[model samples]
Target: MDTRRILRRTRTGACLLAAVALLTSGCSFGSTTRPVGSAAAAAEEVPALTPLPRSTPAALEPYYEQKPAWRDCGAPGFQCATLKAPLDYAEPSAGDVRLAVARKKATGPGKRLGSLLVNPGGPGGSAIGYLQAYAGVGYPAGVRARYDMVAVDPRGVARSEPVECLDGPAMDAYTRTDVTPDDAGEIDTLVAAYKKFAEGCGADAPKLLRHVSTVEAARDMDIVRAALGDWKLHYVGASYGTFLGATYAGLFPHRAGRLVLDGAVDPSLPARRLNLEQTAGFDTAFTAFAKDCVRQSDCPLGGRGTTPAQVGERLKAFFAGLDTRPVPTGDADGRNLTESLATMGVIAALYDESAWQQLREALTAAMREKDGAGLLVLADGYYERGAGADFSNLMFANAAVNCLDLPPAFDSPDEVRRALPDFRKASPVFGEGLAWASLNCAYWPVRATGEAQRIEAKGAAPIVVVGTTRDPATPYRWAEALAGQLSSARLLTYEGDGHTAYGRGSDCIDSAINAYLLDGTPPTDGKRCS
Candidate 1:
């Protein structure tokens, strides 16, 4: 999936509210909802929180007292395990955090190239889920035979001691927050809702919250590498995983083997730039969808005479309408299609081309049918709100990591108001609202612990950076930026659409990545594929 879409989807309104509830309840939710104090002031006042020292393999023995039951790879011959690590790395004596690990052994018709770890973005998406459902069974046979395919759910994510919040009814209410606030009162309501949600997360999962940062998760990957007996890490990271992998390369350059970062993120940008660029990206994808829809008989935004711009305007107007009146979804709670849910549905469609049809059906249902069931499904999928209205910790952890990675772009409501014009210029449909939404982390309780820094990883082996020309999430420029930044980076370009280029479709992209993993032959610098 496009890293931006994945991030935006996971950090949607409901998720943000949950994260806020998780982080800010004790600080007087009503009184202290301002941006974090200045870093200098914070540093002088609040001691820097240190991470615990790394534990050796021997240290992990006690935690691994019980062996996991190995199940069928579901792809003929793969094995899975539950690896345990300390929840509070600073205190190894504390309780354990379990990660679901999966591996498809090398077929071995060729020489073994060692393990190749793969992460399919989301920061919330399950790596094991992706492997079992797709990569493990569907990856090219040559590559599969030469390298052991491996995956691990990051800490605080699915199957990894997930951070849980909200019962069914509460979540139903949370998902319907109005994103396009019509007035000051509406905006206050939205902000209050976010505060409540974040407070909930703080209450529900305190220990897990502090340790879910990208840096911490990157550290966790090193532990997984040691347990797997790998001398160095050879990996493929998609979407947000690219950030995780890049952080690893930065922290342990010498340990980085052959790494491939696809659908790259410009780790150097702050949250505002990230959200603004992403808002533009959604516009690009929506424009593509609009054009295609106009050409089809079932086009919901009217026919050829109506331009994509007009379609976007219509959608925006629909969102504005929802601010006043939400469309009913027929669920028991009277679940309605609010502006936040509608925006999430649009963001979800940008991940894969196959979802465009679903988007069309959803838009049709919302605009004409006036039934929100279709849009609700799209929103639910984005939140990973499954059968019981239960949510995955993906959204929770996504915020925890993102909030710690950088300070919020906007320090106050005034800043967001000033940036709206530029944001809308970037993407008329999604700009203003998303630009406002991007201010969320500014209100996070914990001060940001990291800043944007360039990654050179000088001693690491050649690493591949892949970019798709028309990728909606992580834009093509970010790939170029990342490739240029890494000392040994090789740029692999996929001249296509969608999020990450490899495995989703293009053989040219997949083969180049496979060769790098199996034979340690990085693709020629500036290799372009279609």
Candidate 2:
């Protein structure tokens, strides 16, 4: 989904630090000449360009007696390890950063397809946690049987050399900052909050604050691929991970193997465009939820006469109410449903369909029972908050990476104000606020190191780009754009909703992806799945 929103609630540096404590945490060109004929040929086709050299495989030393620090991880048949790589690839001799890695061996009678890496959207989402908790044990057996499922926490993320910021009290204060400011005093408070958060990050992790861009992480992936003894990389990445994977292909095209980029990000777009598109996406998802909610008896928004527009109005009213007077959730810390938390709760429900019912129930409880515990749980889960008020490093790293990848969309309050109307037009439900919130990076302590650029990995093998028709985070057109940009790419469309396609529910999507991972066969171009 929207990387910014996901990062804000779940991995936003300050919010993440507050939550748990605490508890925490390509191508060779083949030349084919079309025959010049009167009716068939509109124009003479040019000869296919020659493909570039493949990335030379690095030598990997096999471990004879590898003993991982295994624990009673919640998932069965999984093991964890700490993998080390240089903090800066440009300086390989520099001190290394420890990455949390997890794996589950292939359960196969058939020949193995080596290691298959998986990342679930958020630049801040814990890859190890996702692997141990879901993909490692929960992925479809057909795919799991042929590859050793693997994941590595990116630099500055959970279990890695995590970036830290605010402590419990500080985080609570930061999350309560008004995101949609209508007055100068409120705007000042928001800007101060961002500045303080950025200052906290710089003070806590200066070195990391400068090095967490998607490009550096992509380089880290290459190092991991070498360490794993894989000749080429096989991976499935969603949301921001799609940007990471695409960056990898661009950097080391020849090293690419079977790749599935679901919920694709358009590498060609700048941060502002991405943010604007995402605001629209969330609005679309809310509209869908609103339509479905009206048909149900338990909808929080009034029923019958209430249209999606009315539901939007009601939610906005709730947000406004929370802004003026927060709702208590009975937490020991006296935490209440502030505007930030409430918005996050809505964003969290956009990830999966199963969570829609949860959203309905939670909204009902908040409106009718005056109890927000259900919504709080969903928000906590999204943030990966722990028992204590401590948090993992996901959000810190997510910001570090995102802020570095592109320039801030807005540099000042005036800029945000000027852009508010367009953002609001994009998505009345979340647009204006998110557009303003996009200014979080403007006050960052570190200077951005990269900019949005097209990735045309010349020698990479065929890559599959999957998009959900009405995805709330990564817009569907991004997938189409990425596929068209890649020299050897094919587009796979999921005519459905929610973020990402494979393994969420559609057998058609899963089977197609499984086939690609098993053999070296990319799905047919323009393939569609429901």
Candidate 3:
């Protein structure tokens, strides 16, 4: 899945959602699309991973037991450290990979409760970025005061030895490639694109690519846990990070302690199942957006009497119109708004409902004024592409981790063709494009190192699995499935619109998580919050 963590910031802390919407608001809700592993996609499982890699084995204690040589990070209060983990745990004698870690010590007069590790779900999102940007400074004061906020950039994410794929110009072409192909020639073009992209990563970082699987990352986390002097791990993971934490729990049940898995993913499902469900989740989000939009003056899709189904049809028509004659975005680079880009701009807003109004405005611009600048900005934001054209390794790592965690969702266009009807049934608006996007890993150079399976984490402490009813990236059903699979799981339901629930302006979610973090008391099973 696309690394699901909404990026923490931009040049403006508010992000480009508003600016983009004001320009591209004419095409809201009805036509959201991103590659299957978009920024809000779910994140993994493996067999050697099942028994739980708990105690430091005799052969590897040397690496795990090594003390972190901490140093001040140029940031005032945080300390940074480097950790070492066996590149191949099964063959510890081969080599080691260096991991980046950071922490803000507890600022307390109260008794310290050790460290609380935080992951902001990308499978690619930088945990260190999350820690410094939000968790360290914005988390509940009590929690921060008593527990050091810690983070470790996964093996192939930012700050860690990153995985590099297509560079900027190449990426721009790849991103703009038509996902909803019209014919076999277009299908060949899409398949060629996937192969080119995957080939770039393999050629650029052959060794690292082979080692960045989810189980390996989870194992890396265990080493970080031991290096931090914590016998047990306390973590709060959102979206894809939820999958990571759950993986860790399965891999090391006895080491798990007080984990809050918001936007939970069902580890048991394969990529095809996960991708299909996520598409449905986006459709659910659009329905909510449409229901809200018709109530407003600038509703682009429909009016008071207009049904969501009609809104979807109108939006699809708009996308089709873009295919024949692209709109000028009025950008300095003269980038026109293509169907793929307009769809990406729409997908950008699905992560948070607060962006719904912006989406409406964006659609208005595209439909009424034929301006595409705003939509382009949203696409940039989703891709984490800065105005300067520099991109983080988020998408690269996202695909690397995701592709390794599960076999490709479909092997070829023929396979996707067979599956297209089912996908369309799931998401008439976005299904075809997403089905094509799923073909990305089919061309991956390395074979998958993990498989989808239930993670019981039987001996772990009470783990809280949070779900949002209208969550677009991680379907609410996945949360229910995950909660059911874990031996000791509590479901915290947020009946709202968005991706994950822990701190999206919800007092109910915050309080329950805080109580769990501080007192080791989880909210009762099936607790509902809005």
Model 3: per-residue Cα lDDT at residue 264: 78
For candidate 2, what is the lDDT? Answer: 0.72
Model 1 stretches with alpha carbons more than 4 Å out: 1-78, 86-96
Report backbone clashes per prediction: 17, 20, 21
- Ranking under TM-score, best-scoring first? 3, 2, 1
Please report how far candidate 3 places residue 420 from its true position, in Å. Answer: 0.9
Q: Model 3, 227-311: lDDT tens per residue?
A: 8899899999887788889999988999999999998777777677777777777788777888888889998888898888888
lDDT (10s digit) by residue, model 2, range 1-530? 33332332222222321211000000001211111242112111212223333443232122211234544454678877776666666665566677777889899978888889988756777787778767787777867898999898888887788888787677667766778788999889888888888899899988878887778787777767876778888998877778778888888888888988988877766566667767777787788788888888989897876899999999999888888887889977778888778777887787666678889998888877878777777766676555666666555666777777777777888998998888888888787677777888888898887776777778789998887877777767667666766778878888776777777679889888888888778888888888
Q: Highest lDDT, which number?
A: 3
- Model 3 stretches astray by more than 4 angstroms: 1-49
Ranking by lDDT: 3, 2, 1
RMSD of each: 8.1, 7.4, 6.7
lDDT of 2 at 80: 75
Worst 10 residues of 1 by lDDT: 21-30
Give lDDT: candidate 3, residue 510. Answer: 92
